[model samples]
Target: MTANSPLANPADPADRGHLLTEQANPRSAQLDRLSALELVDLFNQEDQLTLAAIAGARQGLAAAIDTATEALRQGGRLFYVGAGTSGRLGVLDAAECPPTFCTPPDLVQGIIAGGAGALVKSSEGLEDVAEDGAAAIADRNVQAHDVVVGITAGGTTPYVQGAIAAANRRGATTVFMACVPADQVPTEAAIDIRLLVGPELLAGSTRLKAGTATKMALNILSTGTMVQLGKVYGNRMVDVAVTNTKLRDRALRILCDLTDLDRQAASDLLDRSNQQVKLALIMHLGHLNAEAARDRLAQHQGKLRQALEARVSG
Candidate 1:
C-alpha cells in the first residue's frame, strides 16, 4: 500500500529490478558495436564482478551457514523461497544436498511461488500474490527452529518478502539474498546478503549477473554448511549417496584416494557396506567391521577424519 512496501506495485516490471535478469551495458556505445572477439572480451570482463560480489558477502554467508546449521541441529529444516530464476536456483541447491551430503530430502526444501510447474515455466503472476508466499510457508509448518532463506534479485519481490515475514512471525530465522546494495535491501528479513554484481548485460535482465551471484552464494551456503556439519571429510564428500553409475564410480575413486586401497579391495569394502562411501572408508582406514565402523562414526559425530585419526592413534 505504501511506496516502500513490496506489495505496492507488484505488477510493475521496473520495480522488480532485483528480479530483472537483464542489465544494461555501461559501455553500450562501444559494446553494442563491437566485433565478436571484442564482445566476448567485454562479456568476460563483466562476469568478473560476480566473484567479487560473492567475496564481499563472505561474512553474511558465514553467518547464514552457522544459523542454518544450528537450526538443523535441533531437528529443524532449511527452506528456500523465491520466484523465477531465484526459485529455480533454490530448488537446484536443495536437490543436490541429498546426493552430495546424503541428507534427507526434507532437511533442505525449496518453495517456488508458482509451485513445481513454475520451475520450467515463468509464472510472473504468482510473484505479486503475498498470500501465495505466506501460504507456502504455513503449509510446510515452518517452526521456531527452521531457517528460511528468501531469494530475489531485486530485493523487492512480494512473494519473497511475504515468505520471510511469515517465517519470522513463526520464530524461524530469516535470511534474504539479493543483488542490490545493502542500503536498498528490504528490511523485512533478519539477515540481508547483498551480492551486488551491478546491472545485467541486458537491461533489467537479472538472470545475467544477479542469477550468477545467486547461484554462487547458494553453492557456498549448501556446500559450506554441509562441510561444517561433518558431511565432508578433508575435501572429500564422505557422506555422498551413490545413487547412480557416476556416483558409484566416484565412491570407488574416493575410497582409492583416501585409503590407497586396490580397486578390488575398495570394491569389496563398498559392496560390504552397501555402497556407503563413508562407512567403506572408515572400514578400510580404521580396519574395523561395518558395525564397528558405524559405531566409531557415531562416536565422532559422523566426522570421518576425526574417527579415522582416533582409530590410527589407538
Candidate 2:
C-alpha cells in the first residue's frame, strides 16, 4: 500500500496482532472442512468458554454493578461506549432498560463511535478516531456522579480508550470491559472486567464468543443494578412498563400471583393503578388509595416491599 493512502498509518506503532482476541484458534484450523452438525457442535463447545469467562470476571462485574447502582440512586446516569458489535450490544441493553424497569431514556445511554448509524451499518473506520470518542463524552456533559462503561473486545480500540480517559478527567466512575488481559491492555478504569474468552472459533472474529460474553456481562450488570435500585420485587419486574398487550398480561399475572386478586380483579386493579404493577400491589397490600400508595412508594424510594413493611409496622 502507498504511504499516502488514507488507510495507511506509517507513523502509528501500535500492533494488535498479539492480542488474545486476535489469535487463531487451533481447534478451528479445519473449520472449512467441518460438516454442518460438526460446526454446530464445535461452536457449542467453544461457547462454554463464554460461561467460564463470565465466572472469571464475576468480581469485577459485581463491582461495576455496585458502582452503577449507587450512581443511579443518586440521580446519576449510566453510559456505555464502544464500537462495532460491542457498541450495538451496549445500545441494545440501554434501550431495553426503560420498558423493563420504567427508567427514563437518559438514565442509561449508549455512545458509539459513529453514533446511531453504526448500530446497523458498519462504520468501523470511525473507531480509529480517538477525538470523536472524547467529543461524545463532552457533548453528553458527563459529570462526577455518572458511570461510564467502555467496552472493547480486543481492549485496544482507540475510541473506547479515549472515552474512558475523558470520563476519568470528568471524574466519572469508569468501568472497562474487554476480552484481553491486563498484561496485554491495561486501563485507568475504576473497574476492569476481562472476559478472557480467548481466540474466536472463526479466527479473530470477536463477534462470536467475545460478543456473547459481553452480552451476558451487560445482562448481569443492568439487571443487578436495577434490582439494587428497587425496580424488582421478589424477582419480578415490578416496575415494568405496561406499554403493550404482552406487558399488560405480565403485570396482571404478577398481581394475581403476589396478591389475592384473580385475573379479573387484577386487571381492574391494574387499570386503577395506571397500569403500574408495583403501585397496584402497594395499593392492595398497604390498604391505601392510589394517591396514598404513591406517597408511600415515594417515601420508601419506590421499593414495594419496603413500602408494605413500613405500613404494617406503622
Candidate 3:
C-alpha cells in the first residue's frame, strides 16, 4: 500500500499484515474467463472448505455453546455485533431465535455498526469508527451474565474489535468469530472461533464462504444453547411458537410423536393447553389439567424429560 493509503497505520495489526481474505486466489485466477459450468464447479470445490474450517474449530464452538447456555440460564442475554456482511448475518441469526425457540426478542439481540438502517444500506465506513462499537455495548447494558459475539470475516473490523474490548471491560463473556487466523488479527475475547474458509471464491468478497460459515456457527450457537435451556425435547422444538399454520402442524406432529395420540386428539390437547406443545404433552402424559401441567413444567424448570421422569418416579 502507498503512504497515503487510509489503512496505513503502523500501530494497527490490521494495517501491518497481509490479509488472507484479500489475497488473490491462485485457483480462481481465470474465474471471469471460466464458463458457467466451470465457474460453478470451481465455486462448489471452494465452498467445501467452509465445513472443514468449522470442523477444525469444533472444540472452540462447543465451548462457546456451553458459555452461552450458562449465561442464558442465568437470565443473561446474547448479542451479535459486526459490520457489513458480517453484521447482516449476525442480525439474521439473532432475529430467527425467538420464533424458533419461543425466546423473547430481547433474549437474543443484534447490533450492527450503523444500527438497523445499515442492515440494508452499505454503512461500510461506520465500521471504521471503533468508539461506536464500544458505545453500542454500553448502550445495551451488557453485564457479566451476557454473551457478546463479535463477527468480522476479515478479522480486522475496528468496530467489532472495539465492541469486544468494551464487552470484556464489562466482565461479560465475549466470543470473537473471525474468518482469518489468530496471527492475522489476534483477539482477547474469552472464546475465539476461527472459521478459516481460506480465500473466498471472489477473493476479498467474504460474503460468500466466510458469511456462510459464520451463519452456520451462529446457528449452532443459538440452537445448541436453546436445546440446553430445555427449549427442545429430543429432536423436537417443544418451545417453538405455534403462531402459523405450518407451526401448528409441527406442534401436532411433535405431540403425536411423543404420545400415541391421533391428529385430532393432539389438536384437541394442544387447544386445551392454549397451543403450548410442552404443556399439552405434560397434561396428557401425566393425567393432569392444563394448569397443573404448567406448574409442573415450571417446577422442573421447563425440562420435558425431567418432568416426565418425575411423574414416573413419583
Candidate 4:
C-alpha cells in the first residue's frame, strides 16, 4: 500500500505529514545518474537525516526506556517484534545485549515475522498476517511485566501491529517505533515513536533512510535503557560479560582504565570475579574482595557508580 492510502491514518494530529512519506524525497531522480562518489556523498547526506529524526523523538524514546527499565527491574523481559530489515535490526540489538550488558539470553529477545529463518531471508509475505504476529507473542509466553517494542518503517505493518496488540492485552508495556509519522501507527501501541527520516533514496524502498533511522532509534532505546538500569558505571560499560578472547581483553582494559591498575592486576581481579567486569572493577577500585564487592553492588541495587561512591564515603 502507498503512504497516501487511507488505511495508514489513525487520527493523530502529530502524524499529518506522514501520509506524504512517498513525496518526502526530492533527489530520487538524481540517484539514477550519479557517479560512485556522488552516490556515497548522497548516502552520507541522507544519513544525517536519521540523527535529526531521532532527535525529534527523544522524549518518546526516553519514556519508552523508563517504562522498559522498570519492567526489567521487576524481572520482566524485553521483546522486539518486527519484520524484514527492522526485524533483523532488532535481532542484532538483542544479540548484543547479553555480551555488552551481561543480561541473560531470555531477558532481551527478538521475534521476527517468520521466526529464526526469516533473519537471513525475505519474509515479506509474513508481514501481512496479523494472526501470525499475535501467535508469536503468545508462543513466547509474554507476561504482564514484559515490554514489547514493535518496529515498522511504514508504521502500518499488520504483523507488528498485531504483536503489539497481543502484548498490550497481556498487560505488557507496548512501544512502537516507526519511520513514518505517529498517525500511521495502529491503536495497539502505548507509546508511539515517530521518527520522520523523510523518504528513501530508492522510491519506496525503506531500507534507505527509513531503515537507517530505525536502527539508530533502536540503538538509543537499547543502549540508553541499559545505561539507566545501572549496567554502566559512569561512562564505562562495567557490566560487560567477558565471554571470549576479545571481550576478555576489553574487560581488562576497562578495569585498568577505571582503577589505574596494571594489566596483570586487572586480569587477576577479573579471574577472581569469574570474568564479571563490573565486580572486578569494584573489587579493585574499592579495595574489596569478591564477596565484599558483591555485597556493595547489591546494597546499591546493582549500580556500580553508587556502589563505588558508597565505598569511598565509607
Candidate 5:
C-alpha cells in the first residue's frame, strides 16, 4: 500500500536539528541563572505564545472541527493518534467526551504508540517504531467515514506519521497537527494545523510551549466538534451525563435555569427523563412525556434545538 502513495513516504529524520522547535530561544539563554520569581515570570511570558499559536491556526482548527462534526454526524468515529505527551493529551480529550457530552465511548478514541500502559509510563522509545502506528490504525479498522487526527509537537514523530499514512490508505479523513512549518516537515493530511509557538524555554523540551499549545488546540477541536454535533445548546452542555451527585445537581440547575422549574420540580423532571438533561429539557419544553420527548429527539438526530423547533412548527 505504501509503494505508490505520496502520503506513505517517510520523513527524513536526518538533520531534524534545524527544525524551529529544535532551535534554542535566545531570550532563554540565561534560564538557569534566573531567580525563582524570575523563572516563574519568564515561563508565564513564554506561555502566552501558545495562545498566539492557536490564533494563528484558527482556520485549520475550524476546518478540523467541521470535518470531524460532519463525519461524526454520519456515524463516523473520531480518533486521535500520537505518542508520548501528545498521545496522553489525545486520550485525555477522548476520555472526557463521554461524561461531558454523553457520547458513546467508541465515538471518540485515542491511540498511543504503546497503548494504555504508555499513558502512565514513559514509552517514548515506541514512538520510533513506525509499523506500530500503522498496525494500531488497522487494529481499529479505520474506514472512510472516520476522522483520524495525528499529533506530533515537532512534526516528525514516525509513529504519528505512520498512523496518518495508514489512515489515508483506508480512505479516512486525516488531520495533521504539529508545531513546525510545512516547509520544515511536510505531510499529506487532508488538513494541517500548525501551532507555531517557536522554541521552548528549555531548548528542545517541547513539553513546555509546544505541549501547552497542542493541549489548547485539542481542547478547541473536541469542544467545537461536540458543540457542532448538538451536544451543546446556547453555550450549555445539554448532553452532559448525570452519573454522580455533582452532575445530578448540575442537571437540576440546568433545568431550572432553562425552564420555569424550581430545584424540586427540576429534580422531578430529571427523574421523569431518567436523569437525561437534554430529554428532561425537551419533556418540559415540548409538553411531551419522556418516551415522546425521546422519540422527538431521536427523530431530530439528538438535537434538542431541532426537536423543540419541530414541536413548535408542528
Candidate 6:
C-alpha cells in the first residue's frame, strides 16, 4: 500500500485493538447489501445474544444487587452514571423507581455527561472528558453509603471511568457495567459486569444489542434491590403509588388477590389504609388497625412479611 493510502502501515493503540463492541461482525460483512427481510432476521439473531450476555453476568449482577440493597437500607442513594445511549438508559431506569417502588425522586438518580440536554442529542464528545465524570459524582455528594453504577457500552468511556474512581475515593460502592471483555477496558469496580454480546450488526453501533443488554441489566439491578427493600410483596408492587386509574386498579387487584376480599371490600380497605397497599395488606393479615400495622411495618424496617410473621409469632 502507498504511504498515503488508508491501508498504510500504522501503530494501533492497545485500546483500539481490544474493544469487541467496535469490531466488525463477520456475520454482517454485507449488512448494507442485505434485503429488508434479511436485515430484520439478522437483527433478531443479534438481539438474542443480549439475553445470553445477561445470563453470563448473573454473578456480578447479583453482587451489584446486594451492594445496592445494603447501601439503600443504610439510607444511602443509588446513582446510574453513563453517557449517550447508556446514559439515557440509566436515566430511564432511575426515573421509574419513584412511581413503581414509591421511592423518593432523589433516592435513585441518573447522571449523564453533558447534563440533561444530552439525553436527546449526540453528546459523544463529552464522554472523553474524564474529569467531568468525577465532578458529577462530587456534585451529587456521593458518600460512603451510596452505590454508583457506571455504564459504558465499549467499556472505555473516560467519563464513566472517572465517575467510578471518584466514587471509590468517597468510599461509596461502585459497580461497573460494560459491553466488552474486562481485559479490554477494565473499570476496577467493586462489582464488574460484562455484557459480551459480540460485535454489532452495523459495526460500532452499540445502540442495538449492547443497549438492550444494558437496559435489562439496569432493570434487574434496580428492581432486585427494591424487592430486597420490601417494595414488593407476593409478586405485587405493594409500595406502588396509586397515582392514576391503572395503578388504582392494580392496588385493588392486589388487595383482592391477597385477602380474597370482594372489589368493594378491597376498595374500602385501601381507603382505610390511606391508599397504601402494603399498609392495607398488613392491617388485614396482622388483624390490626392501620395505625398498628404501620407501626409494625416501621419496626420491621418496612418489611411486610417480617412484620406479619412477628405479629403471628408474638
Worst 10 residues of 6 by lDDT: 1-10
TM, every model: 0.93, 0.95, 0.94, 0.92, 0.95, 0.93
**Candidate 5 Cα outliers beyond 4 Å, as residue runs:** 1-14
The digit string of per-residue lDDT tens for model 1 on 1-314 reads 24456443464765444442444557544656788998788778888999999999999999999998888878899999999999999999999999999999999999999999999899988888777888999999999999999998887788887888788889999999988776655556778898988777667777877889899999999988898788998898988999999998899999998888888888898999999999998888787899999999999988888998888798
lDDT of each: 0.85, 0.92, 0.89, 0.84, 0.91, 0.89
Per residue, candidate 2 scores C-alpha lDDT tens digits across 5-79 of 322221143567788998999999999999999999999999999999999999999999999999999999999
Q: Name the 10 consecutive residues with the lowest summed lDDT in model 1.
A: 14-23
Please state the error at residue 44 of candidate 5 in Å.
Answer: 1.1
TM-score result, candidate 2:
0.95
Q: Considering TM-score, where higher is better, how would the candidates rank from best to worst? A: 5, 2, 3, 6, 1, 4
**Candidate 6 per-residue lDDT over residues 175-235, each given as its tens digit:** 9899988876655688999999999988889999999999999999999999999898878
| True lDDT of residue 97, candidate 3 | 88
> Candidate 5: global Cα-lDDT?
0.91
lDDT of 1: 0.85
Task: Candidate 4: list runs displaced more than 4 Å.
Answer: 1-21
lDDT score, candidate 3, position 90: 90
Clash count, predicted structure 2: 0
For 45-111, candidate 4 gives per-residue lDDT tens digits of 8889889998999999999999989999899999999899989989999999998999999999998
Give the per-residue lDDT digits (tens) of candidate 3, residues 1-314.
22333322223645534777777789999898999999999989998999998998899899999999999989999999999999999999999988889899999999999998998899898998767888999999999999999999987787887788889889999999998889877778899999998887787898998998998998889899999889999999998899999999999999999999999999999999998898999999999998899899999889999999999999
Q: RMSD per prediction, one decimal?
A: 2.4, 4.0, 3.5, 4.2, 1.9, 5.6
Q: Kindly report which residue pairs in candidate 5 clash with one another.
A: none
Q: Where does candidate 5 have its weakest 10-residue lDDT segment?
A: 1-10
Pairing residues by index, what is the TM-score of model 1? 0.93
Candidate 2 regions exceeding 4 Å error are 1-14
Better of 3 and 6 by TM-score: 3
User: What TM-score number comes out for model 4?
Assistant: 0.92
